[model samples]
Target: MRGYLAAVAGSEPLTPVSRDWARQRTDLEDEVPVVHEETVTGRRYEGDGIRELRIPRFKSVAGRSGDLTQGEWAETALAAAVLADARPVLSPRWKSQQRLTLGRFTPVTHIRVVEIGCVDASRNVLFEGTPEEAHHRYVRMAEARVRAVKAGGDYLPGQGCGACELVDICPAVPSRPGFLGVDSPPARRRSWSMTTARDYRTCPARAHLKDLFLPRAEAAENTPAIVRGQAVHTAIEELHSRSPVRACASTDAPATPEHWRAGRWEVTGFQARLGTQMVGDHALVCPLHELPGDAQVYPERSLVVHDPDADVVVVAKTDLLYRRTDTWFLRETKTVRSLDESDPLLAYPQLALALLLAHEGAVPGTTEEGTTGCRVELERLTGSGPVLTELDGDDGELLAQARRIVTEHATHWHADEEYVARPGKHCETCPVIQWCPSRPEKSAA
Candidate 1:
């Protein structure tokens, strides 16, 4: 991001010797140097003055790579247009103060902006031109998107809520004085999800590193079981996403199990066969089978709410949310090698969030009786077959159990200021262990 900003803002050009020295340093010993590279082309007409460059960096993950969202495009184009029109020059005195290092102030010049994949070495331009051009493009192609964004009124209290200044008065986030069951006062605002809770339980440093968005070991995250699970989910989601939705069929399972692929996820051999069977099993119990054509179906929709009392933003991602009659259903699907007969909520503590949300009326729909009308279902596609179990979300006993599960998971996490590493055997599978200062090293033995 800094490199892109510097390229746009016209930083001091690197001297040839400095560049070579940096390149040499990067290529230490036998390691290949990943030298930063980019190209900016187009003639700078005389008297064009200074240029303000804007680049909207896009995420570089598999499915998200090489694509700039409509919202992002609209924002960048509108910003460039506004900057080109205003062209306000900051005072030199302000720039001179090192305490406030915004940047060196420069006089106005023609503005140019471009959008690119954040990690694309080719830097293939998505949109690039003068600020006036950007404005025209926005007006012609992107104005409606910008307008729609402005018109959006719903507050989605998520991880970002921790950073939101208006959270104190935000009506969406409920203030439950003892929500997380933590007696210790919050050290600072933070976000807590089941994933965070689980990671913290495994190793505090792993959770903290993930919070900081540190680079992770791809191998650790892409284990065969994980990849198979993702592939199964992608396959199931595609079926649910079809227009004029219909019940999933056995034939919908992967035709070529040897090399089955869905979106950016791929699987083969035993994992592929297992995923195929899971998809087939899901076909037998698809929620849409009994629903009317117009039934609302939301797959992998995120449910975010804030607990101001705990100073935490709670986030849960439901596998499937569907409405039938007056009742809403939150279904959590798990692809497992075998079925377990243990208590589902206790076995999968992640379900506690869904259980609580359903009971608290956080989900959209409700029963005709004017009560929270969410039926929490667990769909386990196991090696044997598909199993569907419904938990009575409105039951007081069940709700209490769910609360205990969440509180147990969240209490220690919410109170900790120093997320110190508790290294152990779990470190072998920690994704961000590469960045852990106290990571265990293999013994020479």
Candidate 2:
């Protein structure tokens, strides 16, 4: 009880009784309560009364005045009732002795009421509530904690990777790309990008390993798919991206593209296998050094949305976002051999996240036509044309899905156990197979 009290002491007033209590009658020694056949005994208190809102315990309090809030007293009162048998009551102090006394704690009734009140520095009365609710919560929390400890379960590092501070010794941290490695870029829990959204949804365990636990594997970036994807996105970013003007740009170029974003990035096709692997595993670089003087399209632009409900920052850099005739068009490109809209981006999170940011006016000019009516095209370079899909859902439905995915991913990452490992064909293509024990053995061709 005192620990809980100590945790939140002094947010408001709890007891109205004055600490500078004065002796009213010569029979003052008669009021102390009896406990365990002992004369209501406690440590002798030099002060007339306990300080207002301070938990009645043997804490090393310096003096009666401090910035303590009244809320602490409420918490203290609850703790006193829950921890009624604690040693603070053994001291010869006045308040400590009366805690178990003849007030309301009786054998016939289990209800324990500890009256508490306090006055603030402004001379305002602070805490006033009864100890019943706080005590109930305290008991429930205590039982839950005790049960968990006895079960021998402990907090794991992947749990709350975003908030954890002890990553240095965490076992799940990867070897090569320890956030310190320059080759492996730091990633966010909710990058607001389609890849991150899909990564967590498809293989949660792999997501945790790659993003939270394991250091990035060495030479992973030299692989064919990674090199090719980067080459592709870089090509497109320079072409259709509304990304900020490059430092290498000529002085005559317009720094700001018209009505489009210039900076959004996606490292897609992770572990993706082309029909036949690249023999030398070299990057397919296709640079567009020249642009049409009258180009209206913009390539990549950064977008950020803070989902108030989820308390997470959703971020994405649009591959291509353009406004046309009061209608906005969102384009996402891929370098895969095949592209299909049949398996629509689950909840179309990337586009949906962008749409939400655009709708809320966080990213202006995302869609003059409106979020639901906007057009999103998945431009697969290997295919003849981009597969077309409309942003179909309402804002609420999309936000709800994003929130659920982001929250569940973070919660699972930090949970005592590993994220659920559901095996499927995708496991064959999982990038973190080195650390994923659940990966199925592939038959030699």
Candidate 3:
């Protein structure tokens, strides 16, 4: 009766679809894109839907060689062939490889500026000249280096592993044999990945070696987290620039002559002040100063300081500065995997330094008054929401601890010992292990 009714209507009866129907819809179809037949080797299948393939010589060098390069090639070729037939080819493995390749080749530059101690930014010159002059000197030095490399002049070997990327590839220098290794010299080594270098301020020795000493061709091969972090930071800055600023109502009269610095300008209903700090009576100093009205302040990102005494400079391009009545706040954006309250590495000392610097640079000799506490609002890029915490006396102590740590590490680093590898969980992901002494055998063996 059902068959007769279906034939009359020219359609199947209305009935529930079995699980198999759904399963078949979801299941990937078997589609072979490429088939390779070798004389000695067996048949090989490659393409989108092909699940299995038989290839000889795969087992012979599987352990020795990191990856089955030949199998991969064959699979890729087969996938292309299958794709050409207008059928979707499954290339999950190839897609992953392409992603890795893209990540590796991506160019990222990490920049960190740390103001060491209280170097008068306005008066104290970096290289005994103007900023432009110093920049020119840097460019000239770079040019001279290029000319030297082109001219095939005498190339001086850098001290320790500060120069060689393939240091582990080659034999360790006899004099500095114990420098990086645990059994060797007692050098204080800090191992950070290229990613870390781009994201944060790493050890100067490591940074110089990888960034300045290593050839551009070699350095570009490895993508450091520091570089990625910096790129993110830059993007945040640009976003902040485009964001609209909400201005507060003006209550008090315009700042008096005594309150205003020389050549100051009041534009957009905000007062901008410029001033310089002087070391002595004879020296005329002018520091680059930018001060917006208290209403115009926005705090977006908190700066981290690694060292205070080692002349390390740390600066942050703030995104949002919040002000409520007389209180001032800073907001800093970060792209971290996770944040822990106990992570002293991200403490408020760096933020304190920024506040202190901003205060001193603007009002000169107002560090004590500026200690009215600050807020570190951590906004995770890939998270549910932002975390806000008030930085207080305890936070100040943490900053002091960070300062001490920096001082101690700097002292150890400058001493006449080889660079010791500070081995820990960080070493597992360290890229410079090829040049690290601690992993000499593990890396080479």
The C-alpha TM-scores of every prediction are 0.73, 0.35, 0.31
Better of 1 and 2 by lDDT: 1
**Candidate 3, 1-445: lDDT as tens digits:** 2322222243223231111100001222257343221111122222222211122221122233244354443333332222122212223422322311111111112111111111111111112222243234434443344334435753322233332333333322112122111222223333322222332343333343453323223343333433334434443343334334322112111243123222122222111111100001001110101233323443343222212122222233354555444344555444443455565334433443334334322211212364444443433332223344444433556546444543333343344243445555544555454444465364554
Better of 1 and 3 by TM-score: 1
Candidate 2 vs candidate 3: the lDDT winner is: 2
Q: Candidate 2's residue-wise lDDT over 1-445, tens digit each?
A: 4343443355433333322221111212258642221121111121222222333232333343355554444343334333332212222343432432222221211222222222112222222233444346445544344334435653332234334333333333322221111122223333223445466668777665665435444454345555555654564455434343221222212222221221232223432223112211111221113334343455675544433223233446777665554555566655555655444445344654554444445443543344434455544455333333455435477555544544443443333245667777766667676667687667898
The root-mean-square deviation over C-alpha atoms between each candidate and the true structure, in angstroms, is: 11.8, 21.3, 26.9
Model 1 alpha-carbon drift over 4 Å, by segment: 1-10, 13-73, 85-107, 110-144, 153-177, 214-219, 367-372, 424-429, 434-445
List per-prediction Cα lDDT, in the order shown. 0.69, 0.40, 0.31
Model 3, TM vs. native: 0.31
Per-residue lDDT tens digits of candidate 1, residues 1-445? 5434433344333221111000001222247653321112222211235343334343333344246576766655565554444322223432322222122323344554444334332233344466567568768766677457645777665566656656656776655556677677766677778989889988888888887755667577568988999999999999998878788999999999887999888899999999999999898999998777777898887766667667777778788888877778898999989899999999888787799877766665553475448889999999999999999886899989999998999988888888899988788878888678897777999
